[model samples]
Target: MTTENRAGGAPAPAGAAASSAFRQPKAVWAVAFACVISFMGIGLVDPILPSLAGKLQASPSQVELLFTSYLVVTAVAMLVTGWVSSRIGAKHTLIAGLVLIVVFSATAGMSGGIGQIIGFRAGWGLGNALFIATSLAVIVGSASGGFAGAIVLYETALGVGIACGPLLGGLLGNVSWRGPFFGVSVLMLIALVATMILVEPTPRPEHRSSISEPIKALRHRNLSLTSVTGLLYNWGFFTILGYAPFLMDLSPLRLGAVFCGWGVLVAIFAIFGAPWLKARFGTARTLYGNMALMAVVSLVIGVFPDNRTAVIVATITSGIFIGNNNTLVTTAVMSIAPVPRPVASATYGFVRFIGGGLAPYAAGKLVEHYNAHVPFIIGAVTVAAAGVVLSTVHRALDAADQEQAHAGHSAQRADAEATA
Candidate 1:
């Protein structure tokens, strides 16, 4: 793939005025705002996990189901997102997702039982499935400066949302566990309104993808390798997100603060650090080093679960690697897969989410059966395995990164010549 295609499949013709990636149309900004809110939903509940467990008389395992239901549903639902968006259009698909999130999040806030909240979260997940899968395509299709700029913008939204979600959750969760849920409902409602008003309807693709296309895309080895690497890495990622709270005996506000710090690092690394590293070290080498560091960090968390300061430091530090890894992996998947971009995205989402959906619940079970430390140990091991998995696909990833680097140099040389 060329550097332009690696950016997110949107490319500009040669010598076209390279517009500033930051300067975007009203529609792009609107969708980006919505993307921020949508992603916030992922970490919004972090501060409230302990609160929910205590209030509902549920166990850690039960509370962890909130992630499982949401992610599992989102994973399965990803299979049909391309089909739905193709038929109804991107604007409508986004609207439907926002509506579902608004309703179900509010309903979850009112739930009398953990079971009820879990069920509502599943509904929310279905909506997320549609919105997330289509949002990238919409951004790529609509934005200026080609695919790279759009993707950076998209990743920026993701980073900002993730960073803020915990802070919002913490502040509201201090009042009540339900506060975060209601908060998300209100915020997403606003996002929905902005989207409806600002984003023009997206044109449908000439050939709508089949429902089975994502699954079939997995037949390609590069896509499969990337997917499994993501899955294993996520096993560690969710374990930290879901289980770390139990180890921290701080108030909801304090836990939220800790995670917010983590999120800040994540956003910074994803938007700035990831690209810098990839440009300097190459994608495969960067990933190898970062994944190894993550394994060490997870092991530290596992070994020092009772050391409050150590745990907090490790947790926040983990965000750096997570953020870098997320950007690199997503970009790599988009670039390396031979299938259509939408199909590749859907297929990648479907496969990786399996690890994300299952990991947290498994973390809970491991804690119940073994100990808190044991779960982190497992998390460490799994993340290490992700690095090993990436090694198998090293040739493909390296080639893609090398091409991108060369293309970037060529572009720079051309610009210099033009100025001269």
Candidate 2:
């Protein structure tokens, strides 16, 4: 947060030095600006799609691929970028991602053919993947006391970007469908400049491995299940984002309201719910509880798309799970790992992007073959399985924590005896 090493010796008391995220300063704002720029791209495109098609004289279906291509590109980027970041450090990755965003977003604005547009869109995804995976890593690393408060603020920033997308998209889309993305291009350029000049290079430990440590970290039980579940949950999560409009074709107003309203609820509750629910249920239980709700909502929505009221209710209910699931799983990953917070956070992010990318394509297939509803069933079932995996991972973490605590106490006693 301070972008300075408080660990060696700062004038602050031990507790103040420890609680840096609470007072993190300019570095926090710099990272937050990066988040807003990244999310604006992801969230803004939907509102402008119709206008984009009209400008290009493309069909409605063709415009849909913009969303698909973006997700797929971002997913692949996220998975590989982690390995790359682990090698170079988080700051380099963040700056590189911002550069990618600037380049691709500009190209997207200038795209001529359908293929050109898709290519540029895909490029933006790659940039986003980099921004996300590494920005998260840096935030955790710089989060003095650790991930606790840092994650809360990070998610809040994400939620704000997502919430503003439709409003920004609609306003800009009216000016020109291409206008919103060009707006994104401008935003990225700012972020690119800020990141290079403002974001402090994350200090890596001298003992940090060269190229493959993150891969080894991935094999840890807590990391593995958390990563896997993150993927499944996001897979289901993005499906709702991808297909809600189609499901609500009976009412245009309802569709718009549902998507926008969900964002509102998530922003309001993500930080607040963590304390109330997390303390009672614990991380694994809270994560599972959200997944269970996701499954139920998917089923209920899939079954009865006719009732607009039920659909909206389902929409808002699902929003409650969005940020808290993030908080729960991310916190769990750190708690489970002996390696350190940054390592676990980055690893969880990489695999989760894999899930986010693939889910849309898979859901498209299900919708093509069976019913429009089939994807929901498949995603739900998969997420439930992920919940089970997380539960098992939690048991492993509890056992490990007990062992570490015992070892620490034994060491303290031995030190006392030696001194006496």
Give per-residue CA lDDT, model 1, range 1-420, as digits (tens): 444532344334322212344678999888888889888888999989988999899999999999999999999999999898878888999999899999999999999999999999999999889888888877766777655566677888888898999999999999999999999999999999999999987777667768988888788898899999999999999999888988988898999899999999998888778877877788899999999999999999999999989889999999999999988899888767776677877998998888898988999999899888998999999999999999998988888766554444222121222111
TM-score for candidate 2, please give it. Answer: 0.81
lDDT of 2 by residue, 1-420 (tens): 111232422222222322344466567678777887787676676555545656788654466567767877786555566567766777888888888888888888777877788889898888888888778766655655433556666776676677666556656766666676788888778877777777777654444433355567776665777788888888888776665555554322333345567776676556667545665555566777888888888777677666657756776677788867765676566555655444555567667866776665566667667666777777778778778877777775455334322322212121122111
- Relative to the true structure, candidate 1 has a C-alpha RMSD (angstroms) of 5.0
Clashes of each: 0, 0
Look at candidate 1 and give me any clashing residue pairs. Answer: none
Q: How far is candidate 2 from the true structure (C-alpha RMSD, Å)?
A: 5.9
**In model 2, where do residues sit more than 4 Å from their true spots?**
1-22, 49-64, 79-89, 201-211, 250-257, 306-309, 397-420
Q: Which ten contiguous residues of candidate 1 have the minimum total lDDT?
A: 411-420
Q: What is the C-alpha lDDT of each candidate?
A: 0.85, 0.65
Q: What is the C-alpha RMSD of each candidate to the true structure, in Å?
A: 5.0, 5.9
